[model samples]
Target: MTRIVLALAQELAAIVAVGFAQRDEEVHQADPATVAAADLSGVDVLVVRSEPRVLNAALVAACDRAGVRIVPYATDAAGHRLAASFGLALLTTLEAEHIVHHTVPPHREPVCGGVIVVWGPHGAPGRSTLAASLAAECARGNRPTALIDADSHAPALAMMLGLTDDGPGFASACRAAERRTLDAAELSRVAQPLRATDGACSVLTGINRPGRWPELSAERVTACLEIARGWVETIVIDVAASLEEDGEILSDMASPARNAATIAALRSADHIVAVASADAVGIARFIRAYGELRALVGDTPVHVVVNRVRTASLGLDAKGQIRRTLARFTNVEEILFLSHEPDIADGAALHSRTITDIAPKSAFAAGVRRLAADVLGQPDTAATAMPRRARRGRKNKPAIADVAGVPAQLG
Candidate 1:
């Protein structure tokens, strides 16, 4: 006994009536405007015409939540060919009689691959560096990886990777998604190849200007991420640092804002890497931001990473002290520490390469690799290496240190 709601025009109503009669299924008529607001708890199918904007992201999401399959009807009274334009299944008058008898599978959300969102509080916590490193490490394996520069405020991923910012990157993808035409192929075209990584990684650069943050609507960003999941095995998103929603009181819930992209990414992420610098100010800011981060990514596993760890910042027993502080203040038991190596970092940035590519043996690279391995549940052989002293005679050089027993393997 299939229960269906018919929200079609006058001419198509008769066809749906006959179809339900022939199939012996229960049918209820609803106004096109009221269909979205109507209760569809017990309904299995929702037959709507292509008029009055029946098919849209919100309506589709509502129908999916109500366990209803939306079937758009294309008839003379409902503006012919509208269904085809919207990429919806068109039901003609002739087929309406048997459409109710056809078995349509329940709407199943597409399975997304591993999605890691690197986020942090305000201040440069090396979020972009860690994100790129994680993506590069994932690309080292057989699975394909994509690195998205979602920082609409300061879009430097293109500059960081030494790629041209003129290409149609993340903003373009969001536009395509808003038009409901973003597919796996379209995403592949919008994502540029990271040439330095030998095509192992694909990068979707951020906007060229900070003021263009409004271009990335939350809905569109979510849609783009969905399409990206279909195109790659792993995705690493470099999100904005500030997560505060300042305009919530004055702005519409669906309207795009500066934090919309970051919030959307956090909501859609499988895992979140919350990064914080090892300095005192960074630690304080992260502590204040942790509650908000947990609220945004409820029930999602968050891996805390303390970037740029150094003895000068946190004293001799830096790791032990930081771990104890975090444990005492918060419930975070495990924290990954990435060493502060300015020379290696600057060298990689100068050459437009990832830490893994330019200095694979560096502590920063080793920490990122270990983090990736932990995320993927794989054993990390790089952690077994022994630390070596930096070459003598280099001025303003800090001693190479080991992170979690993984010695720096500087080339």
Candidate 2:
């Protein structure tokens, strides 16, 4: 049975109070003695108005001790600071039925999703394409995922995937987050749905112009991801290349910076995917900036991805040579090589589709599938044996890293 305690507007609270055990009692916590006497036993949720006289820190702490959730009702803009700071924001009671079904349960743990940030050093290293492909592959495995473009500089996901910016983008999410009103159902409504041949996912496009970078503040982005984690299974975010701190030179450290979004995404990520282009210039850039990355995200496991591996740039045995070069400078455990293949990537870009949808059989696509498998923590066999059955008298071979050009159409 669901347990609740309502203390907001009487008639409004009664809307959801119907068909459930109702307790018409007023509990006040003006002082320590009153709070000590107040009982919150047998209550899973405590819905209260944002009033300083009634819902103070002491009462909130008492609810926490009793394992009772505090949810605000009819909370205004001024009250958001006090109400949102402590309230779970998971209960709608009667307004949103879907939220109640997804979040409000008496006997189950709330869903906590993993955040994956795709980051690369300064220079084009195929971050956007890899993020989209990974999201598609995760969705193919029946995990609900959302692809987010948090890249502030040179945001190009909308044009790459042929999505319109008229709908709510990442900026809207940040605004909603700042107000502490962003929820899973609202997120699902705002995000653009992406459907592939075999699976489907959601996409939150980035800002259209570089001038809109201020919209994605660090605090708001963190708040948004926190709300999303309660419902989504996976969130793949594509962030900017530079991870350097923002507003360093500014006397006022509180001033907003354009790089805040990228920094926030990196800081909040459960795991990170660092895409490094396989070339002299690309490798040099990765080597130079990787140290800063380590300092910024301490103790976070970063999976290395060498993109666009071509022997033309670095003569024969490119994979072995690149691996040796990285081993000399950085203490990396494993490297996932994603070779350049233009046909499939170009085809997907032309049709505004994911590489997983167009090039399901190519070595590049297979590599993406393997990366997805690694992220999901399933056996290598889960991706080794292709989900699709092979044609008669033909066996599907494992993915091979061919020294070729990485497609730039979608990258």
Best by TM-score: 1
Worst 10 residues of 1 by lDDT: 392-401
Please write out the lDDT profile of model 1 over residues 1-411, one tens digit for every residue. 878777877676766577556566787788776678778899888877654245544667788899887787665522333343234555654365545654433453232336899998888888888888788888885567899999978877899888878889999999998786776678788888874343478899999989889988787898788666646768999999878775666556655577889999998887899988888898888888998999878998888988777778889988777777777877787887776667777787888888887877666677877788777667766535533343222334332223644322111
TM-score of 2: 0.71
Poorest 10 consecutive residues by lDDT, candidate 2:
401-410
lDDT tens digits, residue span 1-411, model 2: 555556555565556555343334332222322442478786666666554434555577788789876665443442443344344343333443322333433443222236889999877898988888888887885677888999999787778788887678888988987775676677888899888767788888888888989999998887787666644678899999987677776778898887999999998787888989888999999998889899999987788889888778899988888888888998774888877766777788889888877877665666776677677675555344544443221344324332132333236
Total clashing residue pairs per candidate? 1, 2
Q: CA lDDT of each candidate?
A: 0.74, 0.72
Model 1 per-residue lDDT at 67: 86
lDDT of 2 at 137: 83
Off by over 4 Å in 2: 1-113, 386-410
RMSD of 2: 8.5
Q: Tell me the lDDT of model 2 at 318.
A: 87
